[model samples]
Target chain A: MTPGPTPGPLPGPTPGLRIRGLVKSFGGRRVLDEVDLVVERGEVVSLLGPNGAGKTTLVSVVAGLLRPDAGSVSVLGTDVVRAPRAARGRIGLAAQDVAVYPTHTVEENLRFFGALAGLRRGELRTSVDTLLETLDLTPLRRRRARELSGGQQRRLHVGCALVHRPRLILLDEPTAGADPQTRRGLLRQVRALADDGGTVLYTTHYLQEVEELDARVVVLGDGRVREDAGVDQLIARYTRSELVLRFSGEAPELPWPGARVAGDTVFLPTDRPGVDLVKAVELTGQDRERLRAVELSRAGLEAAYLELLGAGRDE
Target chain B: MNRALTVARHDLVWLRRDPAPVITMLLTPALLMFFIKPLYVGALDRLGYRGVNGAELAVPGMTVMFSFFMAGLVTESVFREHGLNTWARLRVSPLRDTELMTGKVAPCLVLVMAQSCVLFLLGRVVMDLRVRGSLLALLAVMAALSACVVAFSFLLCAVARTRRQAFAYERVTTLVWVILGGTLVPTELMADWVGSLAGFTPVYWASHGYREVILDGEGVAGVLPHVGVLCGFTVLFVALAVWRFNGGADKQHWD
Candidate 1:
């Protein structure tokens, strides 16, 4: 099946999106505060934030849905505010909410949206056929959108956005209701898009998806971008592995920088787990025998996200 | 124009898939024609409407009245997109504001015409209601009536933020049109002040033209003035809706 536009080498060296000092307010409260972001082509950036963290506000500005009070937004080098139709034509947005037509059949919903996105009739049919198979919605193509279960509807929602094969996709919590299989398939398609030199800005609460896609993580909180780095870099910077020693008796006082005693056990957070463990054991002296068991907990992206937004925010 | 028609077809496709509009259009008119026709026939005789069968007056009048109820379907066509989470998707399409407005109003226009046909035909075949006026003049008036109501419905859809709000507005409009505009009872029978006020409602002009066609056998000469009034209301409502939508584009998005 023929794919949608390849977005290969767009005019004037257009990156995916370049946002500068964007700000938006609602009822005297700034929902997006001087936000700045840049996602180049062939990059998959996962935006992570708790509810009401302004992740929605940031992308909505880029998608040309809401105008920012200040700063500039450019999609593929075209000003989104000045050239809205041109910028929006290159962008596909799958919202946190399922936006497919409920009463229209699955096939109808996809083709209708694809046509609006300016897909030719023949190409639209082929692309839809491929999406139905790729998303595993082929069997339900004839069924009305409302007849699908939660998981099926989620896939259809994402499929509508992809049918146009947009160069830059801004997907917000696209995997919210998908089953495990569907989620995996959807991620595979996202991976394929990046591999095809397309750019993606994905927002999700699931850190596992970030890890699987190996996406660069950008965190939003308090109406601003809190952090932007590769997933591995974020995990390494924010969270360190921990070594816990369960003692049969009261553990001896350890001089390690991050060592604390709780009942008969000691919890130590260290950058070098092996070296710190040796130091702690040597310091235990005669109490070393009291160390009945040792356990190591590796740090993950979830830890980094918590460390970043885990401050005194209402989420 | 292409985008607008495509959007309109998309909406119509969904509306067809849902049985609610179809059942309401078919059943509601049939029920009103059969049950209300007899009551009006007796009631009109008591009220001194002796020259014409009450079914002819009641059917066209009630048809015009219930056509206002078509506002419900029109509003639903729009508000339901937001409910189903698709409004933002539609907005981002490469459509001009005029195209979007056309797309929105097109299906409502088609539906109102269909509804008029159903109610008028049910009166003719089922109740033996005869056309005393020029059929062409009556057809032109009905066509204008449909367009006027459709425009009113489109304005209501554009102004309403939610389904509940649209329903409330439609309810109030229905009451005003039925009581004040002579859709429920003859305007001549109402008090002098009420009759004077009825002249202001577009529905009064629409059904009043229907009365000329059904009772007085008037041709285009008689129906032209009423049709002109209906056209005026259509233009007024549509122009206001377009102004609201185009001027408030950012507000609609941020909302």
Candidate 2:
């Protein structure tokens, strides 16, 4: 295998995964069109998209299961297509669906998958033990995988992928069927993994999963990467903070600079809702006194993502 | 090699945990052999075949036939991963197609051999199956037969997309194999073309090997040719499986 460039003193880590001009088609229909994405070391890039947005397809290509019509996927500086075998050890993928042996115990499933990653005997045992505890599967380790609850199975599925501890991990909506608590557990672990220098490419429906992880957002729509930016940048460019001011009787729209009245409330779009709350009082003279209650709504990833997907559908 | 073994161990661990399929594959054939052994010996006696023992003549044939039919367990082992959704887990891993199939193949191979030996042992203790021939020769033939059946199982799995499809193919082919191989009737009674076609299948070699050792007392030297033929069929079947698997014709559970 060709060695990557020698590292110099650097502030940010190099790109662990880089895909360029990725195009894939099935039955004459293009599923991924010139998709480009980069996730640096210690970076968690959420591959956010709705159903049929080609999230799984892109993941399949990167994981070396699906060959792309045109493009290259380099994982940990090794091209997955050209050197899939070399790239395999450096990459771990937790696909959207749960894929564990139902007949085996949770620990056995963990051990089997971990061993496949080429871990040694002692290393394999240690990895499985830590993963079982981390994934909250320690108590249920001896239970048959099929006997676990839905949430528990989902967690076990994630554990199977992470048991190998690959440097570059692709989580294709791992939390899809997980309950809220299970989802939080998975997100927290993913975040901790990233903090420990693992690059994560997580795709999800729940925007909060990405939000809580504080991951960079790579919004996909129409088989293309529509937006790639940090959480703050994505929210700034695609969402607006809405400040709702309910009136005692009638909403007066003559005070706040950006306040728009709808029925009995005035809405203001601002970056800071807390500071803008005082602005509403100072800017509106009699309307502020007439204000019954104030509600500040922050611009969030959920709104930005929906708007992006909605616009893609419109186009 | 270790990777393939790990995948095999994964299957083995699960199989041992449940064990119902393996147990059924073993017992079903043993029971069938006992019922059919008497009828075979009675018919052969009435036909004036002097030295032929009914249990020896009919028991091994029934044993191999049931072994081939129960080879559908191979389909169950491979495709059940699809049903349970664990196949995709292996697919996306570093495990190669050959390695995955090799791992899946070993457990079935071991099970099929054990099933065959158990039936032969039970036949010997109860039904007057003599040691007129070399015991090692009989075991060698059984091992070869097991390989052929196991190889066929893997190939059928590679060709078919679903568990139903694999079993359907297994049913169709096993009937043809049983007929051509002379499991139900003697190949000596078969027409020229039917016997010729049977010669092309692994079943014919297994039955031919058993008769040479058990009835003819041919020993190692006598059954060598049959073992060679069965081994050839084993290679052919396994190669066919590898070809389809490598060609990417088999539908993956991940897709």
Candidate 3:
């Protein structure tokens, strides 16, 4: 958890990543509008957003690949725009695209990026060896990147970014098109990195990963921060569990209030599934013989994300 | 500078894995030099040099002309990073744009210089070519020409929007310079008006320096002006490249 040499005065113990009044536009279309966010040290923040929701734009701006029209981004107390080199030294960005040199072997790719990050002889070697083992790339270390399969290449791509053991890691959909094993390995590494006091900002369409990482989910939509909370908290606050009753034949009219029917199944949105299940059964006393199954559908991260995004569209 | 060298070392490693392009570039000129020696000898004879064999002009001429294709190798290396989607990764690293460009341009510089030295070695060993001037002066000309080619490649990378466009530009520009600058035919042997345009090409000065040392037996002092002109061209190309190169621009990597 040693901080790299930051070449400026610090404003106390700063967060790993901080953005305020951030704005970015492309061809007059605002992609990010007055956004504000902060990720503390040792925190793993999962950024959730739909396509075209400016998730990649935000990552690009933080990586110093694109200039932001407004606002400020500070990485580990260094302003990204003002001192890009200093900020960049502390950030490791694995872009959404699978980027690696096809001509270079897995080990070469790791070493090259490590050297660029100013890692020297023995330290660079140790980092590369550890990353190869962590990413399950040791056996394939000598294999050129082009020879690896899609999933193997994806793993190597992510491996190249963090080989320098950067302070702040930005993973933009690191698991896209990855196999189940690759995805799991990456998620585990991300969690481990965070647990070791390294900050991580991860973006993914897969909500399960967020829950798996126990990350604080930040749902972004319409160029603004919509929701920021823990996964269970979001589910609890934004969604309701449903008491579902499926009948064998045509669903009879339920006398219970707030009951909705679709295709012989009745749905009752409820905070208390046990009491509602009993009430639903009692209400369908005569039709109870035809009831095929009773189930409670608990809301999860996906439902909460949908509710948040849907609410965004409503406004 | 060390970071740039690291990148350069990375590029050199990749070159070792696939040495076909470098191998072809180095060997292509030797074959051309061997086949065109008689023509060069006749041309040199017509220019009032008695008993002069063709390697004097053919070796350096082909070396300078083919070095443009060597520059193409650098252009390809730059765009290959983009094509492989590695450019963004490099851009995201801590290296500055100049360092990244240096890393890419350094290996190609070595290759271009190697091509020239190898060609001259073959000329000496096989074509009965002798350098009456200082070898140090000849080496300086080669080094300056290599720098100019590398700079010109960066300018091509800066302006071309697509990989195909870069290749097309490289071929057309190289051939145009070859014809106008006296690589294919000495500017003296070309149409009389072509002389006015010959001095504008970096290759023209490169070839002129070679002639001074190899043909006229000029020492280091004799070829200094041509080397200076080549260096000037290098500076101008570098300035234009820096002005036009946009690291953020979305170049069409494949098309």
All candidates: DockQ: 0.60, 0.63, 0.82
Give the clashing residue pairs of candidate 2, or none: none
Tell me the tens digit of each residue's lDDT in model 3 across B119-182.
9999999999988788999999999999999999999999998889999999999998988999
**Model 3 chain A: lowest-lDDT 10 consecutive positions:** A1-10
Go through the candidates in order and give each one's C-alpha lDDT: 0.81, 0.80, 0.89
Which stretch of 10 consecutive residues in model 1 chain B shows the poorest summed lDDT? Answer: B246-255
Steric clashes per prediction:
1, 0, 0
Better candidate by lDDT, 1 or 2: 1
Q: Per-model TM-score of chain A alone?
A: 0.90, 0.91, 0.92
Off by over 4 Å in 3: A1-13, A255-257
Sort all candidates by TM-score, best to worst. 3, 2, 1
True contacts kept of each: 0.65, 0.63, 0.87
- Interface DockQ of candidate 1: 0.60
